[model samples]
Target: MFQKILIANRGEIALRILRAAKELGIATVAVHSTADAEAMHVKLADESVCIGPPAARDSYLNIPALLTACEITGADAIHPGYGFLSENARFADILAEHKIAFIGPKADHIRIMGDKIEAKRTAKALGIPCVPGSEGGITDDEEALQVAEKIGYPVLVKAASGGGGRGMKVARTKADLSDALAMARTEAKAAFGDDAVYLEKYLEKPRHIEIQVLGDGKGNAIHLGERDCSIQRRHQKLWEEGPSPALDDRQREDIGEIVAAAMRKLGYIGVGTVEFLYENGQFFFIEMNTRIQVEHPVTEMITGIDLVNEQIKIAAGLPLTIQQSDVRLSGHAIECRVNAENPENFRPSPGRISYYHPPGGLGVRVDSAVYQGYLIPPNYDSLVGKLVVHGRTRSEALMRLRRALDEFVIDGIETTLPLFRVLVRNADMQNGDYDIHWLEHFLADGGMSAQ
Candidate 1:
């Protein structure tokens, strides 16, 4: 076991890793930006260091500063809690050169899975279902257009190095393909510094389901089941739940097997997610996230696993302590991303939180970093907290989530709580018949327009 670990990120995830390490008797060193010097994670960590200015590029994404912090603090390992440099293969390699363990997948696996084009090829090689599209990266607009035509009328142009909904464009006709392709490439180049783009047959109204897989270094891997993340806006997940309401037992087993096989084939280790798009009762591989997901708490709630601790243990050369049969989904769980933004216009509202009151009860858990009088900086993501709940059934979980959302209150900044309240009460959401476009259409049709 590592005596000390440096957390290379901030917000609730940093605090989450800190708590897990503390339980395992591991000291934690938190590295934060100048704006987050007084953040909760910094206060809770055994040691804290300021990396750089408020901008993420100069701090959280700064490899030299992070390595320096790890060296000075004598951290045996570094835990990047989602986002920033968590999935960065170069960072992993740098840590390995320094003899510091990166608490995630192997550097090679990260490199392979980080590229969408390579990931699709990998899935195909492993016999996993992947969307029909271009065999690999399309080098030019003509190549993109040709691929789009072969894939049929509706095609999606995506960045080879993209995630989080950026660098993507959907074209419904041949006339739209060239422009969409150019736009996608430009966005990808600007966002990831890679001008590569690929094409895939677009599946309209597909449910975004992902399987959470954990592996030990010895090539053994198992999945904890799936999370239905169809509730999203602009490619960002809003609410996620376990044991997808749309999938049957057979479907679940099939998808889980495919994900596990892929991970094992790649020699993947630690915590990761294999995302898929399910449409017309068929599942197609999309991409893999090489780090802990924001909605991971829902999986833990149902499976009774501490993913963070497992990540650290795996990095420390510990084999997986649990087996596939040992993992069982006991109940339904849901997580609502509480962001400090206007529920109406969806604009970020950053300011001091005059009051912070979190809901608590049986089956309800709140993962947050804010306290009363805490000032939310305008420099980063507007997410302030997450409200997660579990229950014996989907209906029970929904009701519990509704009640919890009502109880959550954060003053002096706009939040999505009001929007969530309206969402849970909608007919489609209540019936569990909602698709990826449900939220967008709902909001466009005056769901949040009223207030």
Candidate 2:
């Protein structure tokens, strides 16, 4: 077992990892920037180290500073709690070279899955279903046109190494293809420093589904369940739920087994998510997140598995503690990502939180690091917290989420709480009748005003 672990990120996820490490009797070292000196994770850790200045480049993303902190703290492992440097393959390799364990998958796996193009190829090679698209990156404009025509109209031009919808553009007609390709390539180059782009046949309406998988880096692996993250705005998921209304029991098991078998075959380790676009009773592989996902709590709520705990154990060279049959999805779970932003414009709103109150009850859980009087720094993500709820059924979970949203309060700053309060009451949301683009369309059509 690792005697000590250093957390390499901040906010709610860092706090989440700290609690899990404490439960396993492991001492934790929290690294923070000058801006986060008063952060909750720093205060709660066994020891804290100021990495650098406020800027992420000089602080959270400083690899050498992180290494120095580890050396000084005598920490044997580093747990990157999503975002930041979590999926940086070079960081993992450097840690391994220093004989410090990274509480995630192998460097090679991270590299393979980090690139959207390579991830698609790997998924197809593993017998996982994939969307029809170009075999690889399209460098020539003529080749891009040819691929677009072959895939038919309404093809999506995507960056080979992009995410969060940064370098993606939709071409609805032949005239749109050239512009879409140019825009996507420019965005791809600016966002990821790579101009490589690919093509895919865009489905008119699809739900975003991802399978939660855990592996021991041996030939052992298991899939907890699937999460339906269809509710989104500008490709950012706001609401997530488990036991999707779109899938039946047989379909769920089939996808879960396929992902688990693929992980076992690859000798994967730690936690990973295989994301897909589901439409017309089929799932098309899109990408793989090699680190814990922002919506992982939804899966944890349904499976009753502490994923962080399991991830730590796996990093400590532990074997599979539970079998596939042992894994069970007990109930329906829902998660609402509460961000510090205007409900109407979706702009960043950061300031001192005058008064704060989180929802509570038997089936409700709020993951947040903010408190009354806490100054939310504008230098980082605008996410204030996550409100998660679980119940015996999807309808009951929806009811619980509605009640919880009503109780959630954060004063002295704008938040998306109002947006959620309205969403929970929407008939489409309540009935699970939504796709990835549903929220955007709803907002455009004055759904919030209607509520």
Candidate 3:
């Protein structure tokens, strides 16, 4: 195990890494932007350093500052929790040059899986199914139109290097294809610095599912089951659950094993998620997240494994302790992303939180960095926390989520608490009958109005 680890991110995820490292007898160093000086993670770390100013480019995303902090603090490893530079392949290579381990997948894997087009090819080569579309990068409008027609209507034009629902556009008819293709490429270039885009047949009403896998980069890997993340808004997942209501036991075993096998074949390292679009009893590979996911807590609730702990250990050359047969889903788990935004308009709500009281009870957990008087800086993502709940059954989990949402209190700001409160009682949500586009349509149609 590493003697010391530096968390190269902020907010709840940084705190999440800090606690896991501490539990494993590893010292932690917290690096923060100027705006996050009073963050809970900074307060709890063994030592904290101010990396840069409030701007992410000058702060958390600054490579030199992060490495300098590790150099000064003698942290041998850096854990990039989720966003920022977590999935950046170049950042991983830089850590290697400094002899500091990046507690995630290898740089090569990150680069390969980062590109959506290449990821689909890899999945197809590994015998994992992929959505039918263009062969590779489509630059010719005529060729794109041909692929679109062959794949049928409602095709999705996606960025080869896209993520977070950016750099993607949908065209329901042939007339909408050319503009969608051009716009997707433009957005992809601006967002990811890559102008390449591809096409795929858009499957209507598919549940977004992802399989979590941990690998040692030494021919050993294990799958920790799956998470249903179909409840989304503008392609961003809002609520996630484990042991998808859409899948059966046989479906789970088949897909989980296939994911583990693919990881072993690819020599994948650390923690990663193999995302898929499941529809009509078929699982089609979408993309792979080369780092820990925000909804990981839901998987942790079902399985008694600490994913962060395993991620750290694997990066240090330790093999997995659990096997395929050892992994088991105990119960139902749910995670609602609590963002600092208006529940109705979804506009950002960043300011001083005057009063903060999180819900507490059996099977309720909130991973957050906010306090009664903490001033929420507006320079970063709108997310302020995550509410994770577990229950013996899916029905019980819904009940617990409802009660917990009612008890959660935060003043001086608008939160998605009201949205979650409304969603918990939603018949469709309760029945687990929602697709990726369901939330947006629901919100637009007064689902978020009076609530």
Candidate 4:
């Protein structure tokens, strides 16, 4: 194990990593922007350093400042808790050059999976199912049109280096192809500094399923099962659950084993998610997240594993602790991303939290860093917390989620709590009869207003 670890991000995830490291008897150094001087993680860490100003580019994403923090703190490892520099391959390489361990996958693996086009090719080479479309990035307008026609109507033009729904456009007809391509390229360049885009056959209704795998970079890996993230808005997942309602035990085992085998072949390290678009009883590989996911709590709840602890251990050259056969899904788990935003318009709501009360009870857990009177900085992501619940069955979990959401209270600002309250009672959500587009359609039909 590392003597000391520096948390390279802020918010709940940073606190999550800090707690994990503490459990492993490791000292923690929290690096934060000026705006986060009084953040919970900073206060809890053994040492805290102000890296830079409020802007992410000058703070969390500032590699040089982070390296200086590590050097000054004598920290041997850094745990990037998702987002920011978590998936930056160059950052991993830089840390390696400095002999500092990065608690994540190898730089090569991150590079391969970070690019959407290369990820698809690599997934196909590993025998993972994939959607049919352009074999590589399409630059010419004529080539883009050809690929779209071959893939049929309603093709999705996506950024080769994109996530979070950016640089993605849907062309429902031949006449829409050029405009969609241009729009996606422009957005991709702005968001990722790479305009390269690819095409994929769009599935009207598919569940967003991801397999969580952990590896030791020694050809040893295990899959913790899958999470159904179909309840999304603008490609951002809001509600996530384990043991997908659309899949059975057999299907789950089959996919889990396949993904584990792929990780072993690639010699992947730490925690990674193999995301797929599941439709018509088929799983199409979409992309791989090279770091911990926001919805990882759902998987941990079902498997009784600490993914962050495992990630740290793996980075420290520890051998794989659990076997595939040892992993089991004990119960249904659900996670609601409680963002500091307007439930109806989805606009950000950041300000002083006059009062805060997180729900608690058996089978309920809230991962958050905010508190009463904490001033939520408007410079970062709108997410303020996550409400996770587990139960013997999906229905039981749903009921528990309902009670927990009702108990959650955050005053002096708006939140998506109202949205979740309405969603919990909707017939479609209650019966698990929803797809990737379900939330968008629900909102389009004035579902929130009706509620």
Candidate with the greatest lDDT versus the true structure:
4
Across 205-288, the per-residue lDDT of candidate 1 in tens digits comes to: 899999999998688999999999999999999989888999998999889988897778777899999889999999999998
Ranking by lDDT: 4, 2, 3, 1
For each candidate, the alpha-carbon lDDT, in order, equals 0.91, 0.94, 0.93, 0.95
Residue-level lDDT tens digits of model 4 in 356-387: 99999999999999999899999999999999
Query: What TM-score, over all chains together, does every model reach?
Result: 0.98, 0.99, 0.99, 0.99
Model 1 collision count: 0
Higher-lDDT candidate of 1 and 3: 3
Off by over 4 Å in 1: none
Give one digit per residue, the lDDT tens place, for model 3 in 317-368: 8988778888889999999999999998889999999999999999999999
lDDT value, residue 95 of candidate 4: 98
Count of clashing pairs, candidate 2: 0
RMSD of 2: 0.7
Put down candidate 2 lDDT per residue, 260-319, tens digits, no spaces: 999998899999999999999999999999998889899889989999999999999999
Cα error, candidate 1, residue 111 (Å)? 0.7
Pairs with steric clashes in candidate 3: none
